[model samples]
Each structure stands twice: as C-alpha cells, then as structure tokens.
Target chain A: MNRQVLLFYPLLGMILLGLFIGGLAYGAVPIPLDHVVDILLGKGSDKIAWQNIVLQSRLPQAITALLAGASLATSGLLLQTLFRNPLAGPSILGISDGANLGVAAIMLYFGGTLGQFADWPISGYMAVILAAFAGACAILGLIIYFSAKVKNNVMLLIIGIMIGYLASSVISILNYYSSTDRVHAFVMWGLGNFSGVSLEQLPFLGSCTLAGLLLAILLIKPLNALLLGEMYAANLGIHIKRTRILILLCTGILTATTTAFCGPISFIGLAVPHIARLMLGSSNHKMLVPVTVLTGSCIALLCNMLMVVPGSNMILPLNAVTPMLGAPVIIYVIVNRKNIQYFN
Target chain B: MAMKQTSVIKTSDLSIGYTLKGGRKKCVHDALNLSLYPGEVTCLLGLNGAGKSTLLRTLCGFQPPLGGKIELMGKPLSSYSQGSFSRMVGVVLTEKTNAGGITVYELASLGRHPYTGFFGQLRQEDHRIIEESLIAAGIAHKAHNYVSELSDGERQKAMIAKALAQQCPIILLDEPTAFLDVTSRIETMVLLHKLAVEQQKAILLSTHDLDLAIQLGDCLWLQEKGRPMACGTPEDLILGGAFETFFSKEGIVFDPGTGKLHTEAPTVPVGVEGDLTTSYWVGNALIRNGFKPSLVSEEYVSVCCNAPNDLRILFPVGDMRIAESIAEMVSIIVHKS
Candidate 1:
C-alpha cells in the first residue's frame, strides 16, 4: 500500500484503542478509566457489579460493533460488484428487510406462544434467529433466481426495491393485528441495538460472518471481471449464474445475522462501499475489499462511541447515529454524479 | 505463411434462423454450404436485414443453426468447450461498451484470459502478444489512455486489437465499418486485409460498404434475403450480376462503363470517334459538366458549349476547331470520319 494506508493503520489502531476504553468507561453506570483497564487486565477491585458491566456487557457490545461493521461493509462491496451498480447493497436487495419481516412476524404474532415454549424445546432467541435466517435465505434465493433472467443491473435494482416494499407491507399487516404487549416488544427491537447479542452467541455469529466474508474474497476474480459487464465477464470464462448465486448467498448470511442480533441498520451497507472507493481511488477488489472492511469497522466503532457520549445520561440509538455518518456520503455521490465513475 | 492448408471453417447444409416454440421457423438462410480457407479475407455483403450478422454469429457458435453442422479446423464447433472455442476463434461484436475508467491496455489484456490461469495471471507470452497486437493495430501509443477518451475510429481499432491479441486462427467481425467515416472505413478494411494476408489467419467480416469490401476481400459471400451466393473475385460478382440483382433498386443503377454507380442518364454525342479509349475520358468530362454520356453509331462531335453565348465548338484529332456554325460542325465531322 501506499503511505496513506500505512498511516491509516496506526491511526485506526489508536482510534480502536480509544473506542474500547470509551466502551468500557461510559455505559449506564460509568467506570473510571483506571478501573476499566484494571478490569480488562483481570486486576480490578472487589466491585462485582463493575466487573459484570465491564466484562460481560460492554466488551461484547464493542466487539459486535466492529464485526458487524466489517461484515456489512464487505457485503455491500460484493453486492455492488456482482450487480455492477454503485447503489446496490445488502439492504437494497431485500435481505435485511426480509430478516426484519421475519422478526416482526415472530415478535408480533407469535411472541407470547414462543416465550411459553421457551422451556419446552427451543428458546425464543433461537426461534428468532432461525426465522430470520429462513427469511433471508428465501429472499436471497428469489434474487438469485431472478438474476439469471434479468440481464440489466438497473432492472434488478428496481426488482429488489419492490421486494423490500412487499415485505414491509406484510410486516405492517402483522403489526396491525397483534396485541399491544407483542407490538411493544417488536417496536423495541425495531429501534436497533448492538447490546442484545450476548457473548455466548458471538462465536457462532462471528464465524458465520467470517465464512460469508471468505466466500466474498474467493469471488474477487469474477467480481473484477463483472465490473465491465456480464457479457464481458462471461467472455472471460466466468460462470455468471453460479457467481451471482454465490454472491446472493453470502450477502444473505451477513445481512440476516446482523439483523437477527441488531435490528435493521440502514445506510452502512449502502454507503460504505462508495466510501471505500472514494478513499482508495481504485475499483480493484483485491484492495477495495480489505479497505471497506477496515473502514467499516472504524465507522462502526465511532458510531458506538458516539452512542454513549461522555457525561450523558441518555444513550443514543445505533440507527440514529448511522444516518448522520452515511447520509452525507450519499448526498456527496449525488452532487458529484458527473465525476464518479462506477463500474470500471 | 502457411499455404494449401485445410479449411478453417466448414458449414454443411446449414439452415440457420430463429426457431419459435410452435414449430415455426423464420429461417434467415437455408441449405447453405461453404468453407472458409485459412489466410483469406472473406467478406459477407448484403442489404439491410439480409441475415449477414446471423450467419456470422451461427458460425462463431453464439447461435445454433436450425439444421446443420459446423466444423472448425477438423473438430465440430459444438464439441469444443467454450474456453477452447473462444481460444480458437476471436469475435469483435458490434455492441458498444458503456463502462467508464477502463484503460485500453486493461481492456486488451482481457483477451489473454483463455491462456492465463484461473486467477488471470498474465504470462510473458501474453504480454508479448498484447504488445504486438497493439502495435499491429497502430494503437500502441494509446495503451495508457482511457477507452472513453478515444474517438470512435480509435476505439474501433482498439477493439480489433483486443481480438488480435487473442491470437485466434479465425476472426469474425460484424459491421466493423458501420459508423466510421470514409477514411476510417478504408483504413480499417486495409488493416483487416493485412491481418488476413500477413498473419495467415482466416478473417470473415460483415459490412454494407460494398465498394471497400469488393476492393479488399479475397472472396465475397453475397446474401440477398434467402438467396446465398459466393464468388472468388469482386469482378466475378460484378460480371455475374450479383451486385445488380441485390443493390440495384429504383432510381439507382450500377454503370459498367465507369465501374462506378450513377443515378442519372448518360449523355455523350453519338458516334464521336478519336480512339475509343480517349473518347471514354471525353465522355466522363461531359458527364461531369452535367451532360449525360450516351453511346451512339453516329460519328459526330457536337459540343453545345453553353458557357458564353451558346457558341457551338467542334473538335477533331485531325486538327479542326471549327466554331459557331452548323457548316463548320459538318466540315469537322467529315474530316474526323
């Protein structure tokens, strides 16, 4: 890399360290910086509540932010390449909305019954995760099936938006009939949070994200070929059908896992790839993929830090913080539309 | 160059067209048989919508023939894998690329994918071929420039260079001069001819520029709707009335006198004599001055020179520049005969 990327690494390192410290220091119950470091090193005082807050609660939240950021950003990059559209992303494909619809149906219509059966066979969290996973896979399968039929990228984008609207309408009908308590629970989940995913579930969630990211990396060659166009990619001997299916599957897994744990976080998946391209000034996936991953992690960590600002009693929602960072980039792309070269 | 080689492409009983689901077929051409020899430029000529592009596509294995067999070299066209088939035959399509920020060299290097490994690593031979192909197409100086910055003619050359870098034995181009100006059209035709002759490759190109095609091609594959014809030379097609039958519509005629097409009547004095060769040039001069040239049995030089005062001047090679009177015209004609 270049000297700028080299400098960015150390700067990102320091920012990551600061965010970790801030995550431990500024939760609902504030811990001193020295005590936070002590708790991290396993040398804290005899305050059991501080240990619980620092070790169990804050650390997993911070790691989840980092992983979710990187996973969603990489997912955005791969989708953009596969579809050859600058505006394509995980949420735009209806994968995230599919997961949201799954969660809404479960929480609004089947919330009380699922909790009643929590001790019998499956837990409520497991049921929600399974429902989200199935919903995500269903939409991904549909997108892949249609990708073979639709040769134009812009048409596929319009189809994806239509799917999202269809899923949203279904969720609205479910919300209208549900009881007040269940609706309240669904509404709380819709607010979006990184604190819901416990440390015990992090390994499974993290590995699934990693697996999807690895598949995306394996597809870099075909992605580069696809940057020109599908016909050009086909001329280069890439099996276009199989490659598009793989991209859908990977984007589905990443989007579903993040939406299962945290509610639908918008704009990161749609905006981060463009940010990475602007920063790197290259469309080559070999460099773009890693840069998007890191930039995503940094942005997510920054958002997490801003959520629990210093000397604040009320915590900001994660979704509320993302638009502030993502909307400007979208506007910048629109304003400089004449200058931005997308596919190639 | 290789000589007396086997046919590079062979089509037997080819009935190619689009087949609908209900057993109805809109056949472009039916029951055709032809062989393309190596080191020859075969030009396919036709009026609009005469299935010239369809034939090229069918031969390249992009579209399947309704009832026929196509063999490249010795093996069947369908028997080869897509990768191997692409390696054997390069194609320059008429489709325009809308991609931006792609460099000319980067676009040309995509042709090396067949020889490159799975990850598309460019080998030394691949680099050499790319450089040589760029030089051959006269776009080596534009390797670093973006494709979007190049003019239409330069971009057309770059596209041809990309196909050349594929190093295929057979090349097919569809309407290569469709949007080019006159000079660019001639230059591209000359480049294709050089590739066919110097590289010893089989080249087939479809074009509506019949004048350039007839001048440059070694063989002509003439198609008129369902009727297909082939001739060895341009003169053969002209003599066989293929050009007249296909292109001569109302108000247009192919004149054999000048070997150039014309849209008006010929007007020259009937039976004017002074070595028929020199009289041909005199007739051309009359036609240039808005007077038609017509062949007649009479032996008289009538010049109604309308430039000044309707002053009629008669000229004979025997030294008679008689002027201004019917008596002088008769005297000049008597001396010339």
Candidate 2:
C-alpha cells in the first residue's frame, strides 16, 4: 500500500470514532459533551434520566448505526464487484426487498402476530425478525439456483429484480386488505429507524454483522481478481460459480440482519461503497473493503446524529436524513464517471 | 515445415462446437488432426464463423470438445484440474475486461495465483519474475499505470506481460491484435514471435491479419466453411496451392507472387521497354491501371522509360507523349486508351 492509502485507514477510523461520540452526545436531550464522557467512563450523572438516556438509548443506537452502516456498505461493495456493475448494491438483488415483503406480510396479513399460524406463540419484534430472515433467505435461494443455471450476470440481475417485483406485488395486495392500525405500523417500519434496537439486542446484532464482515475480509483476494471480470478471474485460477454464490449469501445475510433490526435503512448500502472508492481512488479490495467498512460507520453515525440535530425531541427518520448526504455523491459519480477511474 | 519432435497439444478427429440443451449438436469443424509444437508460432486464420475462436477455447479447456481426444503434454486435457491446467496454459482473450482500478503490477501479479498462497501474497522471487515478464513484454515502464489509463496497444502488452508472468509453457490468444492499429499490430505480432522463439513456448493465436501471419507465423491453420481444415508451414501452404483455393472469391484473387489480395480488373494491352528498374515500375503501373504488358504492335500502345524521371508513350496511331513521372505517363495512356 502507498502512504496515502495507509493514512486513509486511521483518518477514517478517527472520523468514525468522532461521529460515534457525536451520536451519543447530540440528541433530543442535548447532553453536554463532558457529561457524555463521564457517563461513558461509568461516572453517574447527577440527573438519573440523562444517564439512562445516554447509556441505554444513545449508546446502543450509535453502535447499531455503526454496525449496520458497515454491513450495508460492505454488502454494496461485494455486489458491485461481483456483478461488475457500479449500480449494484445490497438492495439491487431484491434480497432486502424480500425482507421488506416479509415484514409487510407479518404486520399486514398476520396482524403483527404469529400465534394463529403455529402452535408456539410468537408476536411483535421477534416474529417480524424471523419472518424477514426467512423471506430474505427464500429470495436468496432462488437467485442462487438461477445463478447456477444462467452463466450471464446481467440475466441473473434481471431475474432478481423480477423476483423482487413479484414479492412487491404480494406485499401490495396484503397492505390493501389490512386494517388502518396495522397499515400505520407497517408504514412506520418502512420509514426506518436506527434506534429500534435496544441495549439488549445489540449483542446478537453485532456478532452476526461482524461475522459477515469477516467473511467479506476473507474474500479480498478473490474480489480483487473479480474486478478484472469473471473470465480473467477464472483464468487466474478462481472458481467463478462458487465465488458468485458466496457473495450472494454474504450480501443476503448482512441485508437481512440489518433490515430486520433497523427497518431496511435506505441509501447506505448503495452509496457508501462509492464514497469509499472515490476517497481511496483505488478499487483493490485489500484497502477498499476496510476503508468502506470505516466510511460506512462514519456516514451512518453522522446521519444518526443529524436525526435529532434540531433538538425538538421529534427525531427525523434515518431514511429521511440518509438521502440528503448520499444522493449528491451518487449524482456526482454518475456525472463524472469518465473523470473518475471505475471500470476500464 | 518440419515440426519439433515433441508436441505440446495433439488433437485427433476433434469435433468442436456448442451442444444445445436438447442434445442437438452444432458442429463447426470435425474430423480434424493437428499438433502444436514448442518454439513455434501457430496462427489460426479463417473467415468469420469458421470456428477459430471455438478451437482456441477448446484447446484451453474453457469448453469441452464435442468428440475425439485432446492431449496436452501427453496427458488428456480433461484429466488436469483447473489449478494444474492454469499452470500449463495462459490465455489472453479478445474480450475487453474492465481492469481500470488495478495498476499494471497488481494485474500482472494475479498470474502467480497458482503458485501463491491463500492470500496471494507475492514473495521476493515472484516480484522478480513479474518484473522480468514486464520487460519481456516491453511494458515495464507502465508497471504502475492503471490498465484503463493505458492505450489499446499498451493494455494489450500489459495483458501479455501478465500471461508471461504465469510462466506457462503454452500461451493462447484470441485475436490479440484485433483492436490494434497497423504499427501496434505488427509490434504485437513481433513480440509474440520473439517470445515463442526465445522462450521456446508454444504460442498459438487467432487473427485476421493475413500478411503478418504469412510473414511471421511458423505454422498456419486455415479453416473455411465446408473444406477440411488445412495445416502447414506458411511457405508450404502458398506453394502447395492451398492459398489459391482457400481464399478465392468472385473478383478477388490471392496473388502467390506478392501474397496479397488483388482485384481482377479489366486489362488493356501495352508494351514496356527500357531501364530495368523504371521499366518494372512502369509495368506495375500498367497492371494497376488495368493495362497488361505485351510485345509492342501497331494496333496497341507501348511505353518506354529511358531515364528515371522521363517516360515516353508510343501509340499505334503514331502519337507520342513525354512525361516527367509515372503518374503523368499513366494518366496520358489512360486518357488516350
């Protein structure tokens, strides 16, 4: 690695750390920076409510934002590299849409309850999460099977989008029949919120997200080879079919887990990889992957901080804040793709 | 015309084509016998849709053959695993793969995957080999430049350097010079020829440039739509009357004297005499201007070149014209006749 790339890691790391702290300190309650530091150091604040808000609410939200951001961004980078298309992302293959369809089915069709379908009683958050996982895996299985049958990448992408459209049609029909209260609940979930995961849910969410990230790191060599295209990668002794399947599985898991925990957060998975590539000026995954992970965390935490920056105690949804930061970069990429070095 | 005692790839009665899903076979060329030798450049030349690319892909094991047997290094081509097969052969395809973000060095280093460890970390020896291959391909100066930034010719050299880094005994290229200009096309052909002779590697390539193949190719594989594939030395193919029949068209003929294509235009009889060098050019101008050289007669026109710059045209009507150059002489003859 060059000096510039080496410096990028720590620079992005420090920025992510700063944003994490910012996410914790700046919120609806407007806790002081020193007090936030004191709370993190385990020194109790004089006000019990401020301490609870900082430690229990903001801290977990910040961590969830960081992990989800990294997961979604890495997932985008993998899909982009795998498909050899810059527009590919976690949502492009319809795995995240499949998850959204599952959540819709749960909230709209089953009235947010699983007790009627099975002997074991389940409802609310746990049941919704399970259904999302099942739905994402189901779509992912179809994609994998089609990937084996079709050798063309563009054909597989089209198939994924068609399957997503099918799922969306079903979701729409379910929403049309559901009552107003259930429809309102589903709409809230669709708006997306990073603060949905409580302090208790962080451990399971963190580990699953990290495991997918680890698999992504292990895929660096093959991913770099793939940047040259599948024919060249296969010439270099890499198995194209096996690598394609593994990428689908990794992206599916990351998109499913993050959507299940945080409501299909938009734009991060599609745009953060481009941000990291533009920052690094190189697409060799050895540096791009880790930098993408760090940049994803920083952007997510920054967006999380922006949600309550007005201090009105009426926080904006994560989805609303994400497009403001991400859309401009995507537009810049599209306009200046020739000036930028992307695919040869 | 004599081949080396050892053969790297030998195929017997090989039928090559894509087999459809319903067991329908689309055979391109069948019942073929050919051998590729070390220290030689074998060029595949044919019209479009004649299965040149298919043959190259089959030999590289990218696709399976429809029938018959292919032996690489005296072993069945299918017996070797992908890892072993990659070590045995290196391929440079014509497809424009996007290698924009990777520097030339990193792209070349990927050739060492068969020998590198799991992470593909290059050792000091690997670096030395890569550097040597870059020099061999004449692309060492652009080692740090991104593949996308290089020109078409430079990107081709970079790919060749990558293949050289693989250290495989055989290198197969599908139209490596297809997108190059005249100078770069000749340069790439010369580079491949040099690599074949110096490294003693069996280098096979498919191309549409016949003049280059005629000059530099050690052996040529000629395929047509229905005729059996012909394989021989370039000289033998020309001398044995194979080039005449293979490349014949309605108005186009393959000239054995110049080994070039010529259009069969109508010829007017003319006679040329005088200085040997200028007379040769004057006769050439006659042929180019649809005139055939013959004995001088009262019924036809004749040209005489006494000096390099002076030309005299003698018409049977007894009209005479002197010109300063071949252009003026040919134009006067063309206007009168």
Candidate 3:
C-alpha cells in the first residue's frame, strides 16, 4: 500500500469509530455517552430500560447499518468496474429487484404470513431471508449463464437490466393483487429500515456481509485488470468469463444479504463507489476497495444516526435519508463528468 | 545467411474465415503462407473489409484459423497455454479504452499480471520493468497522470508502454495509428520501428495508411478481396507492380515512383521552364488543377516559376497572369480557362 492509502485508512478508521459510537449514544431517549459506555462494560445503568435499548436495540442496529452499507458500497464498486459503466449498481442488475420480488411474494401473495409445509412451520423471518436469497441467486445464475453465452460485457449488462425490468413487472403484479393491509406492509418494508435485524440476527448479517466483503477483497486484482476493459483483460491471461461470474457472485451476495435484512436499501450500492473514487482519485481497486468498504460503513452509521435525530418516536426511513446524501454525489458526477479524471 | 533470421510466427497454407453456429463457413482468405521475423516491422495494408483485422486476430490466437496451421517459435499455436501465449505475444488493439482514473504507471504495471502473484503485487523487478517501459515509450513524464487526462497520442504511447512492459517477443497491433493525427501517426510508426530494432522484437500491425507503410515498413503484406495476397519488402512489392492493381478502381491510380495513390484526373499539357525545385511544385499544382507538363509550344500553356514563391502563367489565349504562389497561379489559370 502507498503512503496516501496508509494515511487515508487510519483517518477513515477514526471517523468510522466516531460514527459507530455516535450511533450508540445519541438517540430519541437521550442516553448519556458515559452511561452508554458503562452499559457496554456491563456496569449497571441508572436506568435499566435505557441500557436495554442501547445494548439490545441501538448496538445491533448500528452494526447492521455499518455492515449493510459496506456490502452495498463494495457491491456497487464491483458492478461498476465489471460493467465498465459508471451507472451500474446492485439495483441496476435487478438483483435487488429479485429480492423485492421475494419479499413481495411473501408479503403480497402470502398475505403477510408463513405456514407449515411438510409438517414444519417455517418462521416468517427465515422464509423472507431464504426467499430473498433464492431470488437473488436466480438472477445471479441467469446473469452467469448469459455471460457465458454473450462475449460482450455491454450486452450482458443490457440483459441484466432487462431481467431487472421483468422482475419489477412481476413485483408490480403481486402488489396489484394484494389486499390493502398486506400492501401497506409491503410498502412499509419497501421504504427500508436498518432496524429489522435484531440482536439475535446480527451474527447472520455480519458473517454473510463479511464473507461478501472478503470475496471482494480477493477480487482486487481481476477488478483492476477489468478496468482496462474486457479484451485487454483477457489478453492479460484473465479468464474473462470466470471473472464475470465471480463478480456477479460477489455483488449478488452483498446485495441479497443487505436487501434481505434492510428491505432493498437504495443509493449506497450505486453511489458510494463514486464517492470513494473521487476521494482517492484512482480506480486501482487495491486501495479503492478497502477504502470504499470503510467509507460505506461510515456513511451508513451516519445515516442510521440521522434516522433517529428527530427522536426515536419519529424515525426516518433509511431509503428517504440515503438518497439525500447519495443523489447529490451522483448528480455532481454526471454534471462534471468531463472534469472527472477517471471518467471517459 | 545467419540462419535466415528465425521466424517468430509462421503460417502454412492457412485458411481463415468466420464459422457460424451450424458449422457453415464464410472464407475471407485462403492458402496463405506468412512469416514474421524478429527485429523487423511488418505492416499489413488493405482496404476496408479486406480481412486485415481478421488475419491479425488469427495470428494473435484471438480467433482460430479455419484450416491449416500457425506456429509460434516452431510450436503449433494451439499447443501453447494461455500463460505462455501471453508471455510470448502482446497485443495493442484499436478499441477506445475506458481506463480512466488509472495512472499511466498503474496501467503499465498491469502488463506484469502473468508474472505476479495472485494479488498482482508488484515486486522490485516488476516496478523496474514498468518504469523502463514508460521511458522506452517516451511517456515517463506522464507516469503519474491519469490516463483520461492524456491526449490521444500520449494515451497511445501509454498503451504501447503497457505492451512493452509485457516483454513479449512479438507485438501485434490493430490499426494503432488509425485515430492519431499525421504527426502522431508518423511518430508512432517511428516508435514501432525503434522498438523493433532495439528490443529485437517482431512487430506486426494492420493499417490503412499506405503512404506511411511504404515509407516505414521493412516488409509489407497486401491483401484484397478476390485477389491473391502479396507479401514482400515495400520496394520489391512496388517494383513488382503489386500496388498498381491493388483494389483497382476507376478514378484512382497508384504511383509506383512515389509509392502513393493519386486520383485519376484529366490533365491539359503545359510547358514548364524554371528552376527544378520551383518547377516541381508548379508541376504538382498544375496536375492538381488538371494540367499536364509538356515541352510543346503551340496548344500548350507555358508557365515560368521565377523563384520559390513567384509564378507567371502564359495562357494559350496569349494572356499573362503574375501570381505570388502556386494557389494563386492555379486559381488564375483555372478561372481564366
């Protein structure tokens, strides 16, 4: 690593640490910073209720926000590089739409309920997660199959967009057929929240997102090679087809895990990579990927904190809060594309 | 004969074409024998749709030849694995790269992919090779600049550096000069020539710039549809009249003396009397203005090139016009006629 990156990480590390702690201490209930630290250390809190809220609720929510943000951001970076298109993201590939389709099937078609099948009662949360995973895997499988058949990356990207449209069409149909109550539930889920994962669910969210992040780290070389474009990458002895499949696998895992837990959170996957690129002034991926991961975590924790700035009683939907931060970056990128050194 | 300068790449009775899904084939060229020698620049010149790119793709093993065989270093092309093939041949294609945000140094370092570890970490030697490539390609000054910030010529040089860093024995380029301006085009050709001699690497490129090819190419391959391909030294090919009938068309003529193509135009005979250099340019302007040079007196318009920039045209109608330059003389003579 170069000196700039070495310095960049610690600075970002400090910022991320600050955001993580800030998310824990500041909420609607107005818990003191000292009390939060004491509760974390298992020293009895003056108010036991505040302790439970901070430990069981705010801590898990903050970790979920951090992991999900990093996953989405890395996924965005991977997809953007793989397609050689600046606008590509996890949602652009229709993987998130696939996750939406899964949730729609559970909430809209199943009428907000899960039943026993084969004398086994499927829990609601596991069913939704499984459905989302299945949906994402299905889209990922289609992309991989098409990638093998189509030698052109641009064509594969087009096919992915078309597939995403198809999934959205199916989701629209499910929403149309559902009752008002189920539709409301589906809509609420669609608005997106980082609080869905409880204390018990943090391990699942953390492991899956970490695994996806690790896979992205492993792909740093191929990703950098791909920035040269596919033909040149292949000339460098990279198996273009294998690399494409691997990229889709990584993006699919990250998007699916985050969308499954957080209800198709928007903009983070599409915008964070651009932010990281602007900050680093490079597309090298070796340093870019790790920095993107950290920046994603910091942004997510900040957004999570903002969601409750109006107080716990008036929580902001994450989907609403993210676009405010993410959309402006995208607009700036589009407006000053020629001035961007990396944009061609 | 110094062992005839061992061939880097050779094709024997090769047939290349496009094969469709049902095994149907559309043959572009057939029965071809070609060889590339080390320390030489070979240019493949052809008209559009004449299969220059197809031949290049086949030679670099990007696509398979329909029939016959290709050998690299005396081994069948198919026998070499991907890793060894990359180590042997570097390719520079004409596709506009989207390698924005990547510094020139980083882009060149990618040529070390085949030699580096799984993560592509650049060792001390890798960095040295990359720096040397940058210097050789003459873009070392812009090593830290983003590729998108470089001009077309600089970007092309950067790509050339990347290929140099690959350290392959042979480099194949597909219309490397197609997008460059005249100066950059000649500079690129010169660079390739220097690289071929200094590195002793075999360099092959397909181009439509016949003038530059004839001037700079050590050897040439001329291809045209429905005609047998021609291959030889540029002088030999021109002397053998290979260029005269190449892509034969009604208004275009190949001048073997100058090794350039000229539009076939009607010329009126004119007598030229002056200093050799001045007369030569006046003759050129006359030809372009549809006049032919002749020594005849009657029925001929005489011209006097008094100095480098002075010209006097005496028309057949017994009219005289003095002009300062060839353009003014040609205009006066043309408008008067």
Best by lDDT: 3
Write one digit per residue (lDDT tens) for candidate 3, span A1-344.
36876899999999998888888888888888888889988896999899899988899889999999999999999988876778878777777888888878876887652222112233656677678877887887786677669857667778888999999899889989888878777787788888767766777778889999999999999888888877788778888888887887788778887887788888898899999999988899999999999999999999998887564478888989999999999999989999998787
lDDT of 1 by residue, B90-181 (tens): 87777646345456776677777767776677788888999899999888999877676677788788878878888889988889998999
Q: Highest DockQ: give the candidate number.
A: 3
- Taken over the whole model, the C-alpha lDDT of each candidate is 0.76, 0.84, 0.85
Q: Mind giving the per-residue lDDT tens digits that candidate 2 earns over B47-153?
A: 89989989998998878999999999999998998888888999898865657877899888888877888777889999999999999999999998877788888
List ranges where model 2 is wrong by over 4 Å: A113-130, A137-163, B1-3, B263-288, B291-323
Q: How displaced is residue A56 in candidate 3, in Å?
A: 0.8
lDDT (Cα, tens digit) per residue for candidate 1, span A1-344 = 34665575667667677876887787768889999999999897588899998888898888888888887888888887776677888788887889888878777777743224223233666677677878887887887678778967789988888898999999989989998878776766677777776777788678878997888888777777676566556655667778887887788778887887778888888899888888765576656777788888778877887887567678898889988999899889878866765433
Off by over 4 Å in 1: A1-54, A112-130, A140-155, A308-311, B1-4, B19-26, B96-99, B179-187, B229-235, B249-337
Model 2: CAPRI class:
medium
Residue A164 deviation, candidate 1, in Å? 1.7
- Candidate 3 lDDT at A153 equals 64
What TM-score would every model get versus the actual structure? Answer: 0.80, 0.91, 0.91
Taking the candidates in order, what DockQ does each have?
0.26, 0.59, 0.65
| Model 3 DockQ (Cα-based) | 0.65
